[model samples]
Target: MALVKVQRAAQITLPRQIKDAAHLAEGDYLEAELTSEGILLRPVSIGSREPSPEQETEILAVVDQERKAYAAEHHR
Candidate 1:
């Protein structure tokens, strides 16, 4: 297995071997999940009209974060 480091801003650069084996390319999208073992990433195709479940989850997460931030700032 290849090893990778989480960089600043929580970004990770996939190793060349891993990218080649997975047929990943720039502009490709991946769905990330937390499993019992570790983080899981799977390549997914997104439709132009409909958002994938993973994307919806990500959107909700972002909305939740923004709402909390706004509430904190406005309340104080």
Candidate 2:
């Protein structure tokens, strides 16, 4: 497994090998989830229209909020 460091703001830089293997590029969208084993990351293709950076940030924020809510409900 490739090791990656979480930088400031909880950002991670994907290793070159992983990027090439996954065929990921700059501006590509990824869907992340908290799974039983660990965090899962998958590439997301939104048809032909790619969201702007601001939109992507907003989407991720909403996702994070939902994830936190779910975890809170289940962890009690």
Candidate 3:
């Protein structure tokens, strides 16, 4: 087991050994979750390529529309 200190902004620098063992590299994404014992961290990739700026805008617009529709339906 390894001990690490959380720095400012709640960031902890993963030990070099851990990174190398996990085959992690720069720009890699990690998914973190709280567990009963402690925090769990795992690498994740949403897709082969990241969405473009226009796609992000469209996705947000769809989410906003769905939220408004749900609110209206429930606030009857």
Candidate 4:
């Protein structure tokens, strides 16, 4: 349904719609597998360690921005 071109480092950026549908974020982790059908990507959350203060701050800022955007769209 969607197409993505692989970049120089064999990296592909998921489209915004796909990312939102999967509830994925910038720092989220994913598991990749080669299945019988095709490549499969599964989002995985492995909390190995706590985020640094700066990372936490950046995450909170992103969350706040997304919340505001959602609220505006939903008239909340």
Candidate 5:
């Protein structure tokens, strides 16, 4: 594990090894999760927008298809 110190300005520099492992880039958003073990950082996409109607339909269709498949396999 790599160690990083927080600067006086309240900024922590992501380590080079961690950066390469996570494929992080400048301006990328990261979410910090605090757990009993330690702090976890995860990359997340942030935006303000609604899903397109077509995309919503497609997502529902995919979920329905998966449910059908699951039922067929387990209901046998």
Candidate 6:
């Protein structure tokens, strides 16, 4: 187990060991979730942005339409 200290700004410097273990780099995006156990930090893909549910549905609908079109085009 590693120990971390919170700085004056309430920011904690992630230990080098932890960073290396997590394969984290500068400018990397992380998602933090607080739970009863502790804080969970997950590294996310760079440039990943959350989309609203409506946007997600729209995106999926577009993909489904494209796939159907492609299947229809290739069908015998």
lDDT of each: 0.79, 0.81, 0.77, 0.78, 0.72, 0.73
Number of the predicted model whose lDDT against the real structure is largest: 2
Q: Candidate 2 or 6, higher lDDT? A: 2
- lDDT per residue, candidate 6, 23-65, as tens digits? 9887565676789999998887734455567866886696678
Clashing pairs in 5: none
lDDT of 1 at 6: 75
Q: Assess the local accuracy of residue 73 in candidate 2 as a C-alpha lDDT between 0 and 100.
A: 78
How does model 6 score by TM-score? Answer: 0.55
Better of 1 and 5 by TM-score: 1
* Candidate 6 lDDT trough over 10 residues, lowest sum: 46-55
lDDT of 5 by residue, 1-76 (tens): 7789976434589988899898887756667778999888898764423446785587569667866886787679
Tens-digit lDDT track of model 4 for 15-67:
99999999988878667778999999998765633567887788679767866
Look at candidate 4 and give me any clashing residue pairs: none
Q: Over the stretch 1-76, how does candidate 3's per-residue lDDT look in tens digits?
A: 8999977435589999999999887756677778999999998774544657886688669767866886787679
Candidate 4 regions with alpha-carbon error over 4 angstroms: 48-76
Judge candidate 1 at residue 8 and give its lDDT: 44
| Stretches > 4 Å off in candidate 6 | 48-76
lDDT by residue (1-76, candidate 1, tens digit) is: 8899976445689999989999988867678888999999998876643577898798779867866875787678
TM, every model: 0.61, 0.65, 0.61, 0.61, 0.56, 0.55
Model 2 lDDT at residue 45: 87
Clashes of each: 0, 0, 0, 0, 0, 0
Alpha-carbon error at 51 in model 5, in Å?
A: 16
The order by descending TM-score is: 2, 1, 3, 4, 5, 6
In candidate 3, which residue pairs clash?
A: none
